[model samples]
Target: MTQPSFGVIGLAVMGENLALNVESRGFPVAVYNRTAEKTKTFMAERAQGKNVTDTYTVEEFVKALAPPRKILVMVKAGKPVDAVISQLKPLLQEGDMIIDGGNSLYEDTQRRTEELEAVGLGFMGMGVSGGEEGALLGPSLMPGGTPEAYDKVESIVTKIAAQVDDGPCVTYIGPGGAGHYVKMVHNGIEYGDMQLIAEAYDLLKNALGLNHEQLSEVFAQWNQTEELNSFLIEISAEIFKKIDPETDRPLVDVILDSAGQKGTGRWTVVSSLELGIPIPTIYAAVNARVISSFKEERVAAKEQLAGPSGKYEGDVQSFIDKVRDALYCSKMCSYAQGMALMGKASEEFGFNLNLSEIARIWKGGCIIRAGFLDKIKAAFKENPKLPNLLLAPEFKQTILDRQEAWREVLAVSNQLGIPVPAFSASLDYFDSYRRDRLPQNLTQAQRDFFGAHTYERVDKPRGEFFHTEWMENS
Candidate 1:
C-alpha cells in the first residue's frame, strides 16, 4: 500500500475531526490512538471509503506515514505530550517532524523543540483554534518551527485552514513556541470578549428589563454592525434564542451562572505580568471567571451585601443604545490590550511576529475572529511599528466618540449595584493610557519614605533619581 501523507495520534474528537479534514482535502492520513479500539472504530465509522489507515501501535503508526514524516499529536498538554514524544522517539527516523496541536505552554514547546532537535528530529508547536466544528472543517493554524520543517507542512496546513477574502487562516509563526504563545493570547482575548458580552447581557437584562427574546434581537442587531460583528456575538444571539426542553425557558436561564475555564486565560495574565505588560482588560476578564467560580460563596454573600435595589426607570431604547456603545468601546480596549501584550512578547521573545499577518489570520476561524480585526490589520499594515491599536487614528477617534456613553453605562451599572469589571477595567485602561500625568508621584514618595527607593522628578531631567531624608528634613 502507498504510504500515507500525514499521521495523527490521539483519537479524541479534535484529533479524529482533524484527520478527517486532512483526508477530505485529498491527503492520505494514518491515524492511531493509545486504545487500539478507538483507531479501529473511528476508521470504520468516520474514515469509511476515505484514504485513511488505522495503526494499532506507535511503531506501526510511524511506519505507515511517508519518510520525512509529518505527525500531529492532539493529546493532552504537558506530561502526556512528553510521554507521546518519548514513545515516538524510538520509532521515528531522523528528519521526521512532530507537531503538537495541544494547548501546551509555549515554554514547554521551546524545551521540547530543543530536546527533539538534539536527536535530529524537528518539532512544531502549533496552535489550532476554532473548536471542534472548525477542526472538522477548517481552523486557524499557527505553527512554529524551523523554516525547513514549516515548508514541508505548509501546503497541508494552508489547505486545512479556514479561507478568508485574502487567504487561508494558517501561517508560519516564528520558531520555538511562538505559535502557542500567540494562541495563549488569543484565548486571553477570547475570555475578554466573552466577559464583555456577558456584561452587556446582564446590563440589558437587568437594567433594561429585556427578556431572552429581546436580548437575542439586540445581539443580532449588534452583530450586523461593523464594530461589533464577531463569531462570539453571533453565537451569543443564538444562545439567547435556545430554549430549554425541560424547563421551557431560555437555555441560558437554565444554565448555571458559574463559569469554567481551562487555564489559557490565566496563562495569558501570568505571561503579561512576567513580561511587565499591562493587559488589564484581559486580567479583569480572568478575574471575573475566578469570581464566578465561587458560586456558593457568591450566593451566600449576596444575602449580606447591601446595595441599591430599584429598577432602572430610564428610557429603555436610550439605555440600550448606551450599553451597546459601551460594549463596543470596551471590546476595542480589550483587543488593544491583547495586541499590546503580543507586541511586547514578540520583542521580548525575538519572535519577529508579523502583527498584521496575525490579525489577518485571526479575522476568520478563531474564537476572537471579528470584523474589527480587519481594522487592526490595516492599522498594523499602515505602521508595522504601531505601539498600540488604541493609538491608531480610526480607533482613537471612535473611542473618543463613544467615551460618553461608555462612562454613562459604567456609572449606571455601579449605581444599580451591578458588577461590570471587564467593562470598568477597559474604561480605566483607556483613561490611564490617555493621561499625560498621573498620581504616581505620590506613590513614588510613599515608596521612597518607606524603603528609600529613589524617585525621579518632573522638574529635573529623567534618569536623575532623588532621595529624601524624610525623618530629618520633614
Candidate 2:
C-alpha cells in the first residue's frame, strides 16, 4: 500500500469533504474517526474506489501516514480540539505537523503552536472558509505558522484551494493565530453584511410595500451592480423567490425570524472593544441578532409601542435607488471597521498580516467574496499603510457622492418607523471617522469633572494633559 501523504481526524462533513478534495487532487489520504463504525461507513459510502485509506485506531492513523506527517484536524473547536491534540501528541514523531481547520479563538491557536513547537512538532492554525460544498470543491485557506511548516503542506493545500485569476485563495497569513484572527473578523464582517441586507429587505417590503416578487427583483437587480455584487445579496434574491411546498408561501415568510450565532461575531465585538477600535457596524449586527433571539419580547413590544403608523409615501423608484446607495455606503463602513481592527491587532500582536493578500484571497470561495474585495485589494496595494478603507480616494469619493442618498434613506426609514440599527450605526461610524473635530471635548471635560481624569488640550501640543477645577474649585 502507498503511504498516505496526509491524514485527517474526525469524520464530520468538513473533514470528510476536505479529505476527498485532497484525494481528488492526486494525493493519497488517510482518514480516521474516534468511532470505528463511522470510519467503516465512510469508506463504504464516500471513500470507496478512491485513493483514501481509512483507519480506526489512533495508532493505525498515525502509522498509515508517511514520514514527516501532515495532519488536518476538523473536529469541533475548544475542548474537542485539545482532547484530540493530547491523544496525538505522544504518537506523533518529530517534524510531523498538525493543522487546525476549525474556527478557534486565536489565543488558543497561539498556545497550541507554542506548545507543539517546543517538542520539535509543527502546528498551524489554518482557517478554511466556504462551508461544506467548498470543502469538497475548493475553499479559501488562511494558513499561519512558520514558513517551514507551510512549505511542507503548501503543494497539497494550494492545489485544493479555490483558484482565481489573481492566484490560489491560500497564503501564508503570518504567524501565531493570524489566520484564525482574520477568519474571526471575516465572520464578523459576514454578520454585518447579512444584517445590512436584511435591513434593506425590511425597508423595501414594509416601507415601500413591495411583495415577494418585487422584493426578489430588487435584490436580483442589485446583485448585477458591481458595488452590491456579493454572495449574500445573490442568495438573498434566490431566498425571496423560494416557495415553501407545504404552505405554498414564500419560504422566507414561512421561516422563523429569530436568528442564531455561533460566537465569532460576539468575539469580534469583544476584541474590538479591548483594542479600543470602533466597529459599530459589526457591534450593531451582533446586537441585532441578540435582539432577534428575543422573538417573544419583540412580538409583545409591537403591541405596546406607539410610533408612526403609515408606509413610505414617496417616489418608489427614487427611494429604491437611495436604499441601494445607502446599503453600499454602509457595507463599505462595515468592511472598513473590520480591516481597521485587523490592522490594530497586527500591531498589538506582532502579526505582520498582509492586508492586500487577505483581501485578494477573500475575492473567491469565502462567504464575503465579492467584486468589492478587488477594490479593497487595490486600495491596500496602492497604499500598503492605508489607515482606513474610507480614506482611500476611490472609496472616499464614492461615499461623499452617496452621502446625501444615504442620509435620505435613513430619514425615510426613521419616518416609516423601520429599525435600521446596522444602517444607522454604519452611517454614524462613517460620520465619526471622517470628522476632524468631534464633541469628545465635552466628554473629556465631563470625565475629568467626575473622576479627576486629566484632559488633553487642543490649543496646546498634542499629548499635553490638563486638569481644570470645575465650579471654581468648589
Per-prediction TM-score to the true structure, in the order listed: 0.98, 0.98
**Model 1 C-alpha lDDT versus the unseen true structure:** 0.92
Which candidate comes out best when scored by lDDT? 2
Q: Write the per-residue lDDT of candidate 2 for residues 145-195, one digit (tens) a residue.
A: 888899999999999999999999999998889989999999999999999
Residue 231 lDDT (model 1): 96
Encode model 1's per-residue lDDT on 1-474: one tens digit a residue.
567858999999999999999988988999999998888889778889888999998988888888889899999999999999999998888989999999999999999998999999999999999998889999998999788889989889999999999999988889898999999999999999999999999999987789999999999999999999999999999999999999899999999998899999999999999999898989999999998989999899989988885557888999999999999999989998888899999999889899899999998888889998999999999999999899999999999999999999999999999899999999999999999998999999999999999999889999999999889965
Model 2 TM: 0.98
Error of 2 at 309 (Å): 3.3
Query: In order, what lDDT does every prediction score?
Result: 0.92, 0.93
The per-residue C-alpha lDDT of model 1 at residue 414 equals 90
lDDT of 1 at 110: 92
Residue 220 of candidate 1: its Cα lDDT?
97
Q: Which stretches of candidate 1 lie over 4 Å from their true place?
A: none
In candidate 2, stretches whose alpha carbon ends up further than 4 angstroms from where it belongs are none
